[model samples]
Target: MRFFLSVSCFILTFAAAAAAPVIEPPLPMEKAFRMEARRDGPDIALRWQLEDGYYLYREYLSATGDDGKPVEMSTPPGVIKDDPGFGSTEVYYGTATATLVAPTAGMLKVTYQGCQDGGLCYPPTTVDIDPATLAQAMDPAADGPVSPARPQSQAAFPLVSKAAAEPVDGPGIRISDQSANGVVGSLLDRGGVLFLIAGFLGLGVLLAFTPCVFPMYPILAATLSREGESLSAGRGFALSLTYVLSLAAAFSLFGVVAAWWGQSFQVALQSTTATLVVAAIFMALALSSFGLFELQLPSFLRNRVAPARGSGGSLASSAALGFSSALVIGPCVTAPLAGALLYIAQTGDVVLGATALFALGVGKGIPLILMGTFGSGPLPRAGQWMERVRQVFGFLFLATAVWLADGLLPAGTGLLLWSVLAITFAVFIGAFDQMRPEAGGAARLAKSAGLLAGLYGVLLAIGAFSGATDPLKPLAPIAAARSDTTTAKKIIKDSFQSAASAAELSSLLKADANGAPSLVYFTADWCVTCRVIERSVLSDATVANALEGVRLISVDLSKITEANRSLMKELQVIGPPTMLFLDAGNNEVQASRLVGDITTQAVAASAASLKESL
Candidate 1:
């Protein structure tokens, strides 16, 4: 009886195991991603409808005509995804469309690839298209469901793997296209991992002189003065180090986010509200420096605050200020920065990228740290000179406030504010006062500087009243009649048509009927580097002559709107001071691209190179 029962149990277990369902293999690549080609107005549209639980890679999508020449295709922004295999990349779910310009009414070839939600990736699929039949292949007016695509034989169209599609040297960016940022990236690729930190540190020190990092000096000085008599070299270094560490952390965090998501975190912080808040903070600090109401924590919190090393109220405030300043102040996209971001984005190696970025911050802070160390030196710590120095910092803080608020003000309002500041400075220095014969050398020097300041203030007032927008070129309009170069500058400046939206940019590009090569300049009013480049490079007569017939379009991104973000994404522009060179057909010549402040010679060279390419 026991043997019979055991045998019955064994048979039942075997039956249950045999009855279990088997997992079915995934569908073929062509069936998973259905493709349909049709003529949609003047453009040939290719749509890929993905199966449930499947998505396509935007980077894999490409089209070419019968002449075997690459065709211009526009695709909507895709969802950013971090795939274990592909790193940080953009993908499309549900439906994806590639709109291509009609290429001489010939046959077209489309290639694409996709992967299942948690399964295998499909091999690259190619679809052949005949332009004549595309019109009848699908109805233009109907919104009905698309019919299943006819599967082409695997033998007729060869499958290309992802590895084969990308260049062997890099994933997406070509090695030959060595823009400034690209050169930095190549350095990263070639340099030993251990040496990368030192290299980035040196690069950061070099970038410290750029407009992006210059604003921090005044801010640091103002913060350090708050310590007054108590500020020794040790305390100063400690405070500066805390601020620098916080800044480095903030930069690393932003760099990682931008690389992983391909979104400008700094741009998000440039909203009107953020700008106003920053301005208000600066104004409050300036007032405090001028002996106004003191800023202090409530008594209850002050007593309870931890006294840990670098954890006092002042140090905490310094850390917070450093982090916030990094977010709101400098949004400049320099070569080393862009290269680090690109490396992270392409390789998804946040650790190495972040290390390099931290080293860069340290390098940039070297000078600031030294300044902080000597912030209170030589002179008696409790003299009237200390108060006077404090007042000077107050003026600097006020100037910074004006600069921050300048972008939001109306035309010439910034110049008005600057004029007021200059006049106030002149008054503070006793510019108009009579001098005695026994005056010291220092007093005479101060008066001389004051006189110059007063004169400039008067000039600024005149220019502001005359409707001049540029502080650097306050009398440009008045001088335009006499100087042919100024007149040429005005014409060249006016030649650039502004595009606030992606649609407007497309319209501008399309309206270039003469098929002239174009230069698309990405700019923002708050971008100090952009202003420098505009004044020094774009306005030059030599550079203007070089780009005489090129279509010039400026995309204003001062508002931080969705349209502006879309334009940035479409053009792959990291930030302002970026200039993209386009061919006669409006196709971007990536090799001739420029980012950050550039020289007139560079612009002329790029323009010449672009025309030669055409």
Candidate 2:
């Protein structure tokens, strides 16, 4: 009876679990949405309203007229696509505005969907507006003036007669199009340029605790507390702040240069150089933490420290020192910093870039400043224990460096280099620690010298290897290039392939004469989330079966090639596992585009939506 009861309870629990509703976070609502077209200006501004936990994918817009065909909208001459601000919330949300050159006043249609926290999905909605109506609405003295005191139906969503203008071949604007003009859009409209400014600041604050900046906290705190006088706290605080500001300034400058360089370079940086650089920086930091070498001044350079000796080490001096320290420390947090930089670079807006950098620095600097002001009571005391702490940090840095270097190296070479470095670091640090005396100044100095030698040896080896003929070099380029080519070929072939091949495999579905509504998912093996979707949803029997009616194509972007790279550019695909849907005519359908995480439901819905469009 007891066993029977146990089995019954298990069954009940399973049933309850299956029956439980899936609670998801609220979909980001448009905070603000507005359309601005000045008679004097050459372009129309379609601004968005992005709310927390929601974002609009910028690439797949309604490029066609209501006939469901892709059409090019006039954008301001010389205007570049702006990087949509992916804000800093756990689920970031923000507004984006695009300036399009329009030949005549017509309804601009925007469509979007919302995902609720409870796993409930909102179908795509469109917001449509005639430019003429917007122009009239903007003017208080227009022929048909509506009072602000009137109801929203009268003030905001006014009725318009279709007979006033002949239907043109231009894009059909729908009232339901909410691409940019949603609740969040309104906020952005009200905030104007200031919203972007605030966003940068917010991003900066969040960057402080990232792996890049976190390690510096203890070091900065230790440096500040080393000043043997209580009066030095203010100086230390000032210096820390200054140092942070300098880093911000430097990053801002970088942002300007990067932005000018454009997105292609940014992609290259993210994919290749940036990853390697960040990994190297982390490895170096880890080694330093392990007491591999002390970054200190030489006797000649010691003269510079003399200024820091007396009360002359005022707040200004401290700030200068802090700024100097930042130059070295900034690279450590390059990953997150690079993200912000990339955003700024993509946006090509210097003010916005500067603001973002400033915000990041401020966030990173806060803890250091507070630690300096409050003293090192928050940190572990400087003692034998501190040595252990430093060693741990060194290992961390070493690991980070190895991780980064792996990106630049071929698979075998990267693995070899990482292994060698890891082992070398471990042996050197262990030997030095064993040789050191328990509590003597001379012993400490000797240990420091050993660390220097070890660091020098490691760097020398790296330099030699970097310059020497690498067996991996030839293979690396070929492998990378081949990868790109493979991806491109797959994309092009799958896009143009005979749907008859797919139809031959199944009888329930027929490829329309034009083609069936299909979704092409560009993915990669290296992408973490791509594997997840493939395993969880793409491989599911139900999903696979559902895909029968609609066509599905998967392109592997794991390999690199010029063609693949070009396709990526053409599609404006930023990251892996991007979904693009097309109609039977092989024309693009602006329904739902998802990047990163893929779910069975999303695929199903996308298929359903495309089917309806057909």
Model 1, span 256-304: residue lDDT tens: 7766776554464556777788788878877886788766555555555
- Cα lDDT tens digits, model 2, 1-614, are 44336537744753554355423223323222222222213434454445444444444334333455444543212212233342222221344434444446455565544333223233344655455544423334443433333311223222332213433321121212222122223323455334533554565566666554655565454445434343455555554555555555555554445444543223433455556555655555455555566444454544555455542233333444455434333433232344344344332334434554555566667676677666644444457665665665565556545544543554356445644554465455453666534567766665665565465445444533444222223234344545845322111223323212222212212335544666657665444346456646775655665556556665555554554554443344444566666666544555455554567898777666667778
Model 2 off-target regions past 4 Å?
A: 1-190, 204-236, 264-292, 297-306, 309-348, 360-375, 410-614
- Candidate 1 wrong stretches, greater than 4 Å: 1-157, 160-176, 179-184, 258-262, 296-313, 342-353, 374-380, 432-437, 481-491, 498-514, 559-564, 585-591, 612-614
Candidate 2 overall lDDT versus native: 0.46
Quick one: best lDDT, which candidate?
Answer: 1
TM-score list, all predictions: 0.68, 0.43
- The TM-score obtained by model 2 is 0.43
